[model samples]
Target: MARTLKEATLTTRNARAKLGEGLHWRGIDADTHLGYRKGKRGGVWLVRWRVAEGHYHRDKLGAADDAITEGTLDFNAAVRAARERVEAVRREERAKADGVVHSVRSAVLAYSEMRDARLRERTGSEALRTASSSALERYVTGRVAGGNMEAREAAPIADVPLHDLTEAQLSEWRDALPPTLKASTRRHISADLRAALNMAYRLHRTKLPASFPMTVTEGLHISRKASAEAGEATARENQILPDSKIGEIITAARDVDAAGSWGGDLYRMIIVLAATGARFSQVARLTVRDVQADRSRLMVPASRKGQGSKPEATPVPVGADVLAALAPAIRGRAGGDLLLTRPKMMREPGQLKWVAVGQRPWGMAARLVEPWAEIRKAANLADDVVPYALRHSSIVRGIRAGLPLRLVAALHDTSIAMIERHYGRWIADGLDDLAAAAVVPLVPA
Candidate 1:
């Protein structure tokens, strides 16, 4: 039952006495503040009640003259409002905590409030989120930051609250991704956004929407197996360059004289790729220390996927031409240095100086290759033949030259199974070479 004004006064007086001056206990009707007020007639008990923390203030409800008299202040009405306000506050707190639907902007603010470290720990700190963020920065930010659901934006669903994301909404956004995105690339975006949302919910459990949803099937219908096959076909087609064309490219590169050295770095880099069968990024990221001059080995410290983990440097030996080509770059190898890399591109612009031993700039290289491609096109070469074709040609040459599968695998720093799967068709008929190299007893020694 609600207290009467007289009852509330008595309660306030007792609470004030216990708590001392200036402190008051909360009651249904008001929060009473107690103190002594200096008056013309000396001092008197000054009592006041604040109906709400900042919303309402009442001076003890009744005047000092009426304090000992009627003390009428509609105490019941005040109590009811206070009770309703308290319940409303409780509801808001519960809704926020329970992950009820919030505006996208509000949800974003809540997500940003969590510390990165805390969120990572709670979500197990998967590296994919970092990669996803990179893709987002590249594609999503510029378009969406302008506050438009522009059709050109990749993954428009990211603009919606993660918790409120539904399959239909995801589908709409999926349809909005660039038409050029391969199924694999689309899948990657889906997985990336999923990881981000999942992490948000896990780390900020109390603040996320209670029923967040996602679906990878929204935009594309290509199966993972089909995508893998397409990728494999692409890889195989890339590696099937003619030996005659390879000789022509070599000739084109060698035509550059030492006085100019226009094609020197470009030529040598291509030779290394062919001989080493290293991924373009792998070759680009190589530090001086990664090369073993004495052993003619190309060491890959880590793949793009396995970076920040332990370095997995695999050593693959190269032929003399490649050794000679690379010799210029490795001329004065000091202890502990990068053999090759495009660190200039990796580092933030304006933060580092350009160095010869630094990493290769992939974009710049690709642009440079345009003229090369035009030259090849003039020669009626296949359009798919690229710098990576050197790597593939080297593998094919190794198999054709009667190298053992194990040795080929070692030279390429890949599995025997991979060598067989990729180049076995070209080498399968050459088992006679394998037989010739097989252990045959010359004598019973």
Candidate 2:
């Protein structure tokens, strides 16, 4: 949907120079405006979208193609990028609409659109290292931004409206997904579907019929015990590292450092991971200011899952010893600097030596795979153990220390239901101490 009425003049550098220092506008498909801010030397391209009456938002798309420069955009390219921003805004509006969704298909579409938009907002231009949203959003976007694989896999039952949808119908849908899909894959998709339906009800409760969806109360979560027996569960016994094993792994990370493969990058990352029990994705995104060495806290970024932007950093208390470990990375760095960076490597012309130059962040999760493999071998860790094991190990420690599951979930930024499902078995192991407290009270302390 591109409309280039005034694009001919805006395309050339000579023509743009003549304009005054203000926004020059050209409509794109009647809904969006591809704008250029005229300047003496150079200017930026912008997109203005009016999603609904009386409400509009404008964002910088890139630089105007006045000179051959990075981030500069041509007239045609401006239209293309403008349309993407327009589509994203519209999808967000549709996803969180005040009205009820008529069908599961539409609900899924809305949720997918909302997540994809939010993912881009969350990661900005860094390229999604860890996508807050799932691949279903990609499928939905490719399929007319709504029609791709979501319709293919979750079809037939997707036509049922929320009020009309029953527990049996939802259960059947979950149970009947193709056998070719792995058990974990099936679980993830069902979890997504469950979220979509529940979101719809949560958003438009009053508008829905009195019955609403019965599935909303309990959700489509198949018993974790049942799934574990089926095998390939995401959270499993092997995922949890023991206290002694964690120390061994850290010691091994330091061993890897002697080779200069990771330097302080992996070492510091492991320290935060072990201390905070935060996600690898979260730890990788921390800035120097996020360190807060004085307060002895790591402000974890609140997820931008459903919304268009990051809400705020969640302050999780950490031991002062953890901050002491991070002292090298934090000392004298700018507040906005990345807490951990892989020093940039370069080879001068005609030189055989590759010299370490400046620095770069440990970006994508995939980037860690190679380094992790080497460290894993050094540590003699099991095949199933991974960076995520730090989180599991920490959660298990909290439970064993007699901290409530609800408290553990909050500390780790997850739901109590998740803690109960994955780690509840350990709760029983600690019941003796918990029961002992209750026994003396009843006998009159």
* Top lDDT prediction, candidate number: 2
Candidate 1 similarity to native, TM-score: 0.50
Q: Candidate 2 on 1-445: residue-level lDDT in tens?
A: 3333464257777888887787788777666777898777788899888766655689989887787756678878888999877765664455446654467767777776676665455444334523424544432222333534343243457666655566777777667666777777766777777777777877766545445556554557666566677765555687777878888887877777758655677787777888888887677778889977678788986643443454477788888877887889888889887787776778999999887877776655666677778778988888667788889888888888898777787778777777877776777777766887677445655
Instruction: Tell me the whole-model lDDT of each prediction, alpha carbons only.
Output: 0.52, 0.71
For residue 220, give model 2's deviation from the true position in Å.
5.2
298 Cα displacement, candidate 1 (Å): 1.6
lDDT of 1 by residue, 391-434 (tens): 67777777877887887766665668767766666777567667
Candidate 2, superposed: residue stretches over 4 Å from native: 1-173, 180-182, 194-225, 228-235, 257-260, 303-315, 341-364, 404-406, 433-445
